[model samples]
Target chain A: MDTNQPRWQRRKDARPAEIIEAALTLFVDKGFAATRLDDVATQAGVTKGTVYLYFANKEELFKAVVRETILPNIESGEHLLADHQGTWAELLWILLERWADRMEYSASTGISKLMIAEASNFPDLARFYVEEVVMRSRKLFATVIQRGIDAGEFRPVDPVMATRAVISPLMLIKVWKQSFSLCDTEPVDLKAFARFHYELMMQGLASR
Target chain B: MDTNQPRWQRRKDARPAEIIEAALTLFVDKGFAATRLDDVATQAGVTKGTVYLYFANKEELFKAVVRETILPNIESGEHLLADHQGTWAELLWILLERWADRMEYSASTGISKLMIAEASNFPDLARFYVEEVVMRSRKLFATVIQRGIDAGEFRPVDPVMATRAVISPLMLIKVWKQSFSLCDTEPVDLKAFARFHYELMMQGLASR
Candidate 1:
């Protein structure tokens, strides 16, 4: 490969996202306190100095990693709500399926593990996540649950609490798969778990 | 206060539990790497050297703290199941209430936070917790769910998965409260949340 463009310029263009990806992996693998920036830089295929050029510090890089990975996907929930025209139960299922699909690839899984692990120590990061991610997603699902109730598609239930009920098992399964799989001797079938949740959900929410 | 007896014997008698409690508080307050033995000692009202006498190091102390606080509670659950006779749903709700009550005051809450936060870095600790706490509890609940199906008290579903479904929300909420309350401006009404879940669960598990 010929170098028409300067090294610094090419590195700068490629580094932010690559670095964020690396940072996410390292942070998730090692607790925030234990992770070293040098490791993140090596994971990114860049120099530690290069990472500093893009991100001011480890905390800034962490915030950037989160925003880059999670926030973008999070906003789509609202749009999914707006664009979908279906039964609320169907919409709810679709949303959870979509999330599970994304979780398969996204750094949000790491972010989630990180949040549960470190939220108490890092209030600012935790607050940002709660506001930007948790509250927004809860609102999105709450709207769907409320719509379902209004349409008589679901048995009357507290939209907020019921949404959480619908969400918790799925979320917990994902988190468990990410965090505790090391100790889990048996492999979990993600598809079947989702399906079982859906079938039970159908019965649970049915207006009957 | 007069110490007629030698101080070493007095500390020997009282110190181990106090040190464990202090370690639990500090480990939860600061992530493990950030927590200092000095801080734990100060919290426990002991000397750092005294902590060493009882606990070889931080990790050992952490495990001991877990054993002291959670393992004791963990065994009682199996006993509770052995002693309980009622509807399966009724038994399930009772177990959850007992857990929630324990979570409110127990060091297990902090130990849980620590485990999730640091599990990757400390696989041995995680494995011990998974074996001693998680599996045993899962076994007890799985038995109840299976009995419900066998007796036709609840609808048919994979008892293991169904038990997980029942457990995930309650467990996640407790972990969230333990780990993320700093960022949570709106305090969760634990009782209301549990009540809503129980009602939805009644539907979810009811015989079709």
Candidate 2:
């Protein structure tokens, strides 16, 4: 798009994103404890000192990975909720469809599995993830569910608990793809799985 | 109860179970790739030779750990399905209640988290778990769901996918307890979580 720009300038501008992309790949493949910053530098085709220029440390690099890759999805979902003009059920369906689409196709889906696997070993990172990503995403869902309850479109369930219930199946599928799908003979159809899970949640949350 | 039995004979009889318990603990705390049989032997208070006497290798030890700790829960769940005498909703409630009780209080609950974390590294073992534990458990839930549909007690949905929907939350909770619970400021109450999940599922699956 910017072919007129100098190649050196373009490379300089792209370096941080390229490093973050490399870091996400490595973090997802290897647990946080086993991944090294120098390896990330090698994968990104940058020097380790260059990596330190963009990121203060491995944890910061990881935080950047989360911020760059996942936070956008959360932001988009939040925007969807804020701008939605339809039945709460329709809004929920759209939000989940976007989510399932990302989880099915995006490399960032593996970050959740990585977090689950390595959370105990890195308590600070885990807490950061919980506060930054987990709670934020859950808040988005909770807001939608609470609005549904207020509008008498959903059953009067606690928004916090309802958010957990709605999210758990999606979380399970993400973890499954990263781990068990390696040996799973009959892998789930991601679309069917998502459709059925959303249907179940819709039915469960509907006002009677 | 067996106070009259000789100490050596009793210890000999208990060796396999002791080793299995130790293996489960180590395998859960440290993943399969990181856990060494010698460490398990040490934890079990047995010699390396003693461990080998019972288990052919680490894989065998892991398998035995599953069979000892997890299979029993599955077996008992099967028995509950076979012996149930109630409405399908009530039966499902009881089944989920029992499962939640075990997950909250049992050592075996950690095995689910362990398998999720290490399944990719150990594909053969993952396949083993899928066949022995996952499929068997799903079959139990599918049978109940199928019966409910046939008897006009629940909505018609794919029993296989429905079984997945039902189990996913429980899986998430198990993983959370082992990993994110370390840093989660507002950890969920296990009973309330189980109850709400069960309620949500029951509503989702109802014939209404």
Of the candidates shown, which would achieve the greatest TM-score relative to the real structure? 2
For model 2, how does the per-residue alpha-carbon lDDT over A1-208 read when each residue is reduced to its tens digit? Answer: 5999999989989999999999999998887888999999999999999999999999999999999999998999888888899998888888888888888779999998889888888899999999999989999999999999999999899898888888888888899899888767668887788889888888888898
Each prediction's DockQ against the real complex: 0.60, 0.76
Cand. 1 Cα-lDDT? 0.80
TM-score of each: 0.88, 0.97
* Ten residues in sequence with the least summed lDDT for candidate 1 chain A: A185-194
Local distance difference test, each candidate: 0.80, 0.88
lDDT, model 2, position A77: 88
- Error (Å) of candidate 2 at residue A135 is 0.4
Query: Can you write out model 2's per-residue Cα lDDT over B1-208, one digit (the tens) per residue?
Result: 4979999999999999899988888888888889998899899999999999988999999999999888988898888888988987787778788888888788888887788888888888999998999889888889999999999999999998998888888788888899899778768887788789888888888887
- Show model 2 residue runs off by greater than 4 Å: B1-4
What DockQ class does candidate 2 belong to? medium
- Model 1 segments beyond 4 Å from truth? A1-12, A34-42, A46-57, B1-11, B34-42, B47-53
Q: Could you tell me the lDDT of residue A175 within candidate 2?
A: 90
